[model samples]
Target: MGPTGTGKSDLGVALARELDGEVVNADSMQFYRGMDIGTAKLAPEERGGVAHHLLDVLEVTEEASVALYQEQARAAIDAVLARGRVPILVGGSGLYVRAALDRLEFPGTDPRARAEIEEDLARRGRSALLAELREVDPESAERVADDRRLVRALEVHRITGRPFTSFMPRREYVRPAVQIGLGGPRGALNERLARRVDRMVERGLPEEVARLDAVGLRRGRTASRALGYRQFLEVLDGLSTVEAAAEATTTATRRLAKRQVTWFSADPRVEWTDFREPPEEQLRRALRRIAEAG
Candidate 1:
């Protein structure tokens, strides 16, 4: 696992090929159908004949639930293990990755309280609710930069009568496995992301968004918020130009990469290697670490 555009997907396929494993996607955006180009999902030919599970399992209009994802992803991993093939969980969605591998439990949601919070958010604005969250759960408030996540944090605190950070993941894994992180400096990652966004635009991200918009992409609470997709949707709506959308997408993607790095780096168990390392060297190191871990 690693930040976006850090070659995690390519390395995942390579590792699966070497170990006779299957790839189980942990990226939240890749879960939705018709979001291929924007999410950088690998085409079938690009998969190098390694079977992948949990990609394209959701409609663009559907919401993604980490709790549900935990159930399905774990089942897929268990099946792969039972068949004597390794399961390589891949992607940079840190929470989804943790939900699939860690001993983490999602707190039950209270719709009534959540709706009330939503009302408050619409009425009093995110700053008001965020101030309240700061008083109750400052750690979560600091960590969650978005209003939507802040709202959820406030809702969780209200319902469970607990600090939102109480649900922060522990370092313990729920299964016997090794986590390999692709690490590089921040400047390098930002440059990579800018190039990636440029490639996405050249590859018809705007056209893809137009197609998805006709299919109810706007209704998807999760899919609608995807980085490039959201920005390009504004382009289609005449709210922004292609250049503006590209700029926004690149900026948002860089921020996401930083968050992913922070989230994965906090876990002491993850074995990290330089992103610039040769794939052969990285693979050998990963295999050695897995052997040692076992």
Candidate 2:
């Protein structure tokens, strides 16, 4: 779970091919139908015959939650494991990853905290709620840099009367897995992101956004919160011009990439590598490491 346009899918695809694995979409927006371009969805041919699940499976209008993702992700993981193939969970969505792995022992959510957060969100807007998260759990607030996370954190704290992150059981969750990361100088990553966004727009990203709107998936859902789509939707809603939408999307995407760098930095398990070479090098290393331990 890194950030937008950080080659998570490319890395996952490369690893899946090497390991006889299936790719599970962990990006929240990618689950919705009509969200292909903005979500940077792989084309059928581009998938290189690699199987992918949990992508383009729902209407954009649907309000999908992390709980729903956990259920679907579990089914996909079980199916892949049953087939004797590795289930490579891949995406930039940290919450989705935590939910799927059940790696986080989220303190039970409290109704009272939920009510208060919702009330604040309703009255003063999301900014206020985010401030609340910042005050209570700075680490969590940093990780979850959006209103959705703020709301979830509130619920978690209310239910447990403790920081939601306490459920993570930190040490145990780090075991039983190997993590590989795309590591480069910050300037290099930013350059890569700029090029990636340019390529996305050239590939009819705006048209993809238009199609989502046509399909009625343009409102009131987690899918709608995706980077490009949300900015483009503002264009679709007359809040911004088309050119302005593109610029806004690019800005938000860069911000996401920056945050991803921070989140992965503390993960000692992740071995940083050059993206220039075939990812097989890292995948094989991880597989060997995991296998040797047993």
* Reference-based lDDT, each prediction: 0.92, 0.75
lDDT digits (tens) for residues 38-90 of candidate 1: 99999999999999999999999999999999999999999999999999999
Tens digit per residue, CA lDDT, model 2, 128-236: 7777777877778778766777788878876667776776535334225555666567677777777776777888887888887787755646777788888877777
Query: Where in model 1 is the C-alpha error above 4 Å?
Result: 110-168
Please provide TM-scores, in order, for all candidate models, with all chains considered together.
0.84, 0.76
**Candidate 2 TM-score to native:** 0.76
lDDT over C-alpha atoms for residue 179 of model 1: 92
All candidates: CA RMSD (Å): 4.0, 5.3
Show the colliding residue pairs in model 2: 105-167, 110-159
Candidate 1 Cα deviation (angstroms), residue 41: 0.6
